[model samples]
Target chain A: MKLINKRNFISIVCIFFTLITCGKLLYERALNFTDRYYTDNIFTILGFSVLITLILSLHFYLQKFPFWLVIIAQYALTVGIVFLAIFIHGRFSTNAPTAYWDMFVSITIPFLIGALVYYICFFVQIKRANKVLEKLNSEE
Target chain B: MKLIKTREENLEENYLELHYDKIDEETNAVLDRLRDTLRYIEGTYEDKKVTIALTDIFYIETVDRKTFAYTKDMSVEIKEALKDILEEYSKIGFVRISKSVIVNIFKIKKLQGDINMRVIIFLKNDEKLIMNRSYKNDFYKRLNDLKGRSAK
Candidate 1:
């Protein structure tokens, strides 16, 4: 599997951008922040998106292993990258330990949502393929 | 194109012929399927030559430069290259799913999606084949085309 191809890169960016935007909206609504706000660190978000894309592309390389193992590895890599990014941006030094926990929760929520969406799409595609297969088999 | 048929008493064999001004993609597909309909290859099993019908083959795989055709009950070593077989039978539902494996779409009982965009093919004979990620798109497209053809 070739990683970081144009098609996959575009897909990753789209999914990541949508997930981030929705997450931001949910966060603002929960906090009662009425004003439309965006993150100031555009580079951070872009860099994080690229890194996440690379990490997710690892799934193709590790396909020979069990599905559960691949999921666990991807999730762990995602969490690690998120925390590493936070640390590098100097947020770790200024925030309390509880703030780190909040960050972890934030990371986990979006990751879980992305995973769920992926699985749903994958299963739906498989179901359609199976239906076609059944029809073909019966025809024979 | 014109349709013509004739019934003859005590005919020894049946024959079909086509006369066309030019061959297009659709015409080529029809010709290939016509060729595939009566296709058979000589294979070796237990040091004996066996005539294997193309329709009875579930899949073909090449291992260490030796190509083998697998049927529901037996495997036979064939002299034909995988590439030639696919070129001849692709219009009849044979598709390459990996570097070394060509599977008969009609022989596939079902398909399951594996992690990382790979596909697991379940054959009617209770065997499994993993479709490579690179070939997944072509496989799906071919399968969809076959489905449309069947619907028609």
Candidate 2:
């Protein structure tokens, strides 16, 4: 399907980057405020970004997948990324919560936040698209 | 261009009569253009033949080697191949976004694209289609053409 417009794609990618970067900075600030500083190794940061970039690239490339499936897979990736970050910071067995409840909260919280951001972006795009469609219809 | 109106009580249904002397190639072409705009495509749907206006169709898809023209509520299999559909309506906003589908750009409601260069097209009727990367450029080119004309 040629449903993806190049201009829209480029714009979405730019927005996603901005959102993630801002999210990371705020998260770090919150951590510092709480005196629970998560170690930020340069290599670990690089790896995390790389893995996410690759997964998102794959998700976009496989555009035939249904929206729900994509969401599920993305949530799963979010869990995996959180685990990776915990492991890399060497706090998996130390500062981290080991109970199932804690783990569940950790994963679901970020997943919900991520989902919210995604849906917000989706709705914004929809509104923009509706305006564009209106223009196109007027021209017709 | 000129018009001459006359009241004729014998006319039953508002008859239109054209009076021209020494009609040239240009006039002949104009007649063809008028016919093309009012054209209907004869097709078959569910084993029954139907005629539909070309502009009313949302898109055309070739499934299982058979081509189908889809409107808001029905799908009619047309005798014309995919290539024929492209040749016929592309100039009027029909665009090929995949190997098997030619969507009317005017019918698309939303277009979202991601980093992988894939696009999701949302139709006004709520149907969604992914614009494969392979045909992405063509879709954009046609879209840009529409934008250009609109700008003018």
Candidate 3:
């Protein structure tokens, strides 16, 4: 296995921390919107979000495949994580069946937003690199 | 008993070995001629002193009516037009991949498809070059020819 450089390690840590904090605040807001509607397991939701965030970060950092693969993987992982969160919460209540569609929509919206953000970041990086290359070539 | 009686034994190697040596010699001579021609071209351009390895150059591009050679290390401005360079090096694996780009087929790391029939060429150094729609057919033909030659 390749050792992570200090810069990349720090970046990953920052990303992880930021995602966790935001996820916490969002979870709180979600709870406020429908009090006692979700499973009282904050840890489970946080765990799922962290897992998804790490996967997305890995995809972004490595970038082993083509751009299309990266985008597809990001969307798939985000959607999967959202469903996992709903499943984890729904397991504890008898009202789980009734909340299925509502849970789907709630989970999906955040993931779509996150995917769009990820894509924009990826595109911007590519554009910047291309511009640098163009400038270097132009100098010659 | 009959074999033992024969004055000359059977040849250990096949006749193909002799032909292979001749082909090798011919190939080496051709390569030498190509190198000499490239050296002559390099001598003609006095302003730019460049030693471009066949393996290092990813492609050549024309920008703002000036032609530049793009290598892994750096891009070098060439006084010669793209057509002149293409004429000289196309025989040695360089190919016109687009209107403004002529790529060394050996330096391509991977090929990716962009939207609307365009393709992106990823060089070994991680730089991306585009293959325009118009030159796609000719590009592939040249690429295939290089692959065929290499395989032999």
Candidate 4:
């Protein structure tokens, strides 16, 4: 079995912390506007968690083709989650005004954060690879 | 360039660091042989200067009465015939896929073999060469040899 190195371990810890923080933030925001929305759909919550897990897993796997595919998949998943949020929020509350705008903001924020994180990780890997190439060239 | 030093453990054998400019076997062999051949020719053909690099070569062809080596930069009239050059560089992955032409295997990007019994080779520099049916066996054997060596 391969042991967890310092970098990978730190990355995993940060990802888990971010997921937890994001989930709590979503829950708090949903609760604050409970009169305007229904934030207690178990299936939607589970789907969101699975989507985040898949993104994190893809980020770690680090293959070039799959990384790009995963980014596209993440965007598709964000769209699905947005639709689910609107559906659930509408189903639970009848007299509430159109909370679709709230759903859009909630989905867009996480989507942007996910994209930023993915690109940051991708750029770092590219920098690391270029450094290795440069080192090989210099040694020659 | 930043240098990294890390302690690595081995299970059975002592570690030895192998160093080179690039890792691909075909490329390294082609570059090394090209350099050696250029150096050798420098002494023999002092009046006619020839500079051959991996990138300079376009497609080597035989037309009319002489074998001509075409490059993006310049063309060279080799004293050695097509057969002689092919035999000499066979070890360096040159395969005679047709009667009048021997191509640098490293320069080839893809090979398309069709039911019409013709093999079309797409080279890295976007030139295409047709391989005649007569030399198919020899071409296949050379390709297999290269693949076996590279696998190891």
| TM-score result, candidate 2 | 0.52
TM-score of 4: 0.37
Q: Model-by-model lDDT, in order?
A: 0.78, 0.68, 0.59, 0.56
Maximum-DockQ candidate: 1
- Candidate 3: regions farther than 4 A off: A1-140, B1-48
Could you tell me the lDDT of residue B72 within candidate 1?
A: 91
lDDT of 3: 0.59
Residue B86 in model 3: lDDT: 79
Residue-by-residue lDDT tens digits, candidate 3, A2-51: 22344466555456556655665687798875445344434444554555
Name the candidate that leads on TM-score.
1
lDDT of 2 by residue, B1-152 (tens): 45467788877765556678977786776566556545789998888889998777888899999999899899999989989878877766788988899998888877876543357788877888877655765776677676675675
**Candidate 1, superposed: residue stretches over 4 Å from native:** A1-4, A7-11, A34-43, A91-93, A96-99, B1-32, B112-120, B130-135
Task: List, residue by residue over A1-140, the lDDT tens digit for candidate 2.
Answer: 33335545555545545555566568769886542433433333344444544455555465566555776797687667667656655554454455334444645664577667866765565455556567888765
By TM-score, rank the candidates, best first. 1, 2, 3, 4
Candidate 2: which pairs clash?
Answer: A1-B130, A1-B131, A1-B132, A2-B131, A3-B119, A3-B131, A4-B119, A9-B113
lDDT string for model 4 (A1-140, tens) is 11234456555545644664567567778888443233553344455555555554554343223444656666666677667766776677652354566445655667678677846654454344334333433432
- Reference-based TM-score, model 1: 0.75
DockQ of candidate 3 relative to the true structure: 0.01
* CAPRI tier for the interface of model 1: medium
